[model samples]
Target: MRVAIVTESFLPALNGVTTSVCKVLESLRAQGHDALVIAPGTSPWSPTMTPEHYAGFPVHSVTSVPVRQFRVGLPSYEIETVLHRFRPDVMHVASPFVLGVRGLTAARALGIPSVAIYQTDMPSYIRQHSGPAGDLTARAAWRWIRRIHQQADLTLAPSSAALQDLAAHDVPRIAQWGRGVDSDLFHPARRTDPGTAALRARLAPRGETLLGYVGRLAPEKELHRLVELARVPGTRLVLVGEGPSSEMLAASLPGAVFLGRREGEDLARAYAAFDVFVHTGTRETFGQTIQEAAAAGLPVVAPARGGPLDLVEVGVTGDLFDPDRPGDLAAKVAPLVGPEAAELRERMGLAARDRVVTRSWPALVEQLLDHYALAIRDFSRSVA
Candidate 1:
């Protein structure tokens, strides 16, 4: 099968959308399917570098303009031209916003089926970044999101909470499709690896419990929630990524250890070194990092909202805290920390690993192909 993926972010951008798109492209290549990427051109974030191809597939960069810290792809005649040449079996639109809307329109013009993947929680993000006009802007963002997904042959949401949100907004033809983790890369064995153990000792010199959080250190992530955990006795907060809010978060989270950005083996080591994985973000459509931590054999502590609701088995794998209640996060985390709770943490970590062990990228990609087949059938029927 030939697939054309039009994404809002890709390559040099290290976010959830980019990571998932890369995995899909790799899977498509391994399965002997042809695929290509359409993404924004080089941006301020990585102005000096942008790959021409990835995973042996061509990456066509469209003209883009900077929007705050990231680049936003503009509507281009190049999209239709590229589609006309490739003549894809189906179009995969990832996190459709400006570029995605154009891709869907082009697919319709060429009589091609398109699948829109809903990855980000734009409404909540708008509310977080839009200042006093937050609520109003968020509503407008929802309207735009609804319009985009409504046009697709099928819309794929990453979690049940996200699926319900789309259904509530009246977006049609929705299905739940979650992200997968690399169990081989992020495994329970990494905890004892020499490098990981050394790193863990450095972070928790006095045998303090390491509670880690991975992902961008941005405002929307709600990292400030970690302040309560920071004050917890016998616990140390370890942040594993960098973003616009890095300096501010560092100042606010005094005792926290910030490990700028770690990828591949380094990232896996960081996760393995932690006693518990804590995700403070309340607005995630799907918490990909939570899955990584689970695969690394660490119990999770996340808000009882969004994607965590589907991932954490509460008590069995990890615990969930009420995002609305003050100190609830620290309270939820207390049970899994300290030397007294070592046995409980180990049991929960093993259970966490068990939950995600079967969810490899290839298996999830096969499910994605099933969604693509459904889209093709639906599109064919609509025209008939």
Candidate 2:
């Protein structure tokens, strides 16, 4: 089957959506299926890709602008011509926003069956970064999202929680489609790598514990709460991504180390450097970084909300703190570290890695392909 994927995020823009699409595309082609990508890219657009990068797949790179608030693509249109040439059996929208909306609209007009994945919790994000009246803006965004996703033959949610949220929004034809991690790339062994060791020394020369957060440095991340961790002596807080919040975060958390953004092996090693992997984003629809952290064998501490609830097994793999409780995050993390805590931390880290083994990409991709086939059949029957 031929599939066309349209997403606002893509390569060179490090985030969950871009990485998820790249992984999906690679898996699709390996299974003897052709895939076409429509995503935002640099100034010079390319119709065809080189085998060296992106598996040499056909990608329609659109000229794009940076979203004012966040460091993500807001692609301008040209999806129609790409869709015309590719003529795919089905379309997949990786969180329909600027570019995805165009691709979905074109697919509907061309009578092509499409599937949309609710990768981001946009309404929650709006409430995060949109200042006062944020709640109202988020409500409005949810309605807009519902209107767009209902056009698809199927809407895939990463978690049951997300599906429930979508159902409340009255978006039909929804199903579960979770994220996966590469354990091979992010294993416990990497913790001892020369580069990772060097990083650990650089970040915490005084033997301070490293509490790390990986992903976009956006307002929605609620990094301000990390200040609470700073109060815990003999520990250093590090952020591993770049965004509009970089300046604000650096200013607010002066003691925290900002590693900018790291990808590929560098990213994996960065994960290994953390003594504890912490997630600050309470609104995450699916925490890919949390999965990666688990794969890296780092004990996680996250809010008892959204995606982490699906990933972290309390007291088994990692601990989940109540988002509503004061100092709940600190209390949960307190037990995972300190002089008397090494044994417990190691046990939990190993457990975390073990749990991530079950979320295999091949299985997830096959499931996605099955969804594509089902969506196509349903679409054909309805159109007939």
Candidate 3:
């Protein structure tokens, strides 16, 4: 099947949505399907970049400019035109941004089937950005998002938690797309890197804990908790990505080490190098980073909310703390700091890899193809 993926965020930008989209595209291409990507022309993360090939997939670039410290791409006319010419059997929208909405519009006009992947919590994002007017902004966005997604043949969610949130907002035609981790790339064996040991030694002295958070440094991440975590005696936080709030976050937490953005082996090493994987973000739909940490044979310390709640098996995988309290985060992470945590890490790490094997890219891509077939059949029936 020929598939077209439309997303606002992609390569050069480091985030869960971008990584997940890349994985899906890779999986589809591996199955011998013709897949195309429509992404922002200029990456917000890296300014000195142009249209580039991404891991063999052809990405169609569109006009983009900075918005709120990040790049936002305007709608692409060429994407619609290309879809008209190629006429992909299925189209997937990763976000309800302008690019994704345009893809939805094009698919509609062509009488083609489309699926919208709900990757972010837009309402939560609005609340994070809008402040005093956040509720109004969230409500308006909720309506707009509903309009875009209600037209989808089916809406794919990466987790059941995500589906429940969408259902609360009255979103229809929802199904689970789930998420998977590459065990080969993120196994416990990657921890043998000599550099990781040296790096750990450099970061911590005789008796200090190294808690890691690896994801976009955006407003919604609740990184304020990291600052509080830093207040814990004998603890240091290492943030392994960059984003809109890097400067402010740096100011707030002087002790934290910001590693900008990392990819491939470097990223895997970052996950493996950590003593405990701490995730404070409550808005994640599936929290891919947490899963990656799990794959690295690391125990996770996250809020007992949203995606983490579903992924972390409490005491077994790691401890889940109250989302509202920073103290809870500190409390959960404090225990895993000492020597006996090694056995806990080994146990959780094995279980984490086991949990992700069933959701392999091959299994997911096949399921996605099934969805595409259903969408096409429904579209054909509608046309008839």
After the best TM-score superposition of candidate 3, give how far the Cα of residue 253 lies from its true spot, in angstroms. Answer: 2.3
Q: Count of backbone clashes for each model?
A: 0, 0, 0
* Model 2 C-alpha lDDT per residue in residues 91-160, reported as the tens digit of each score: 9999887778887889988889999999889898777778899989999999999988978899999987
Tell me the tens digit of each residue's lDDT in model 3 across 313-379: 8777788889786488888887777666667667776776666656666787788888888888877
Task: Estimate every model's Cα lDDT from 0 to 1.
Answer: 0.93, 0.84, 0.81
Clashing pairs for predicted structure model 2, backbone only: none
Position 246, candidate 3: lDDT:
93
lDDT of 1 at 20: 100
Please say which candidate is ahead in lDDT: 2 or 3: 2
lDDT of 1 by residue, 260-281 (tens): 9899999999999999999999
**Backbone-clash count (model 1):** 0
Worst ten-residue run, lDDT, model 3?
A: 43-52
Rank ordering of all candidates by TM-score, starting from the highest: 1, 3, 2
What's the lDDT for residue 264 in model 3? 87
Off by over 4 Å in 1: 43-48
Better of 1 and 2 by lDDT: 1
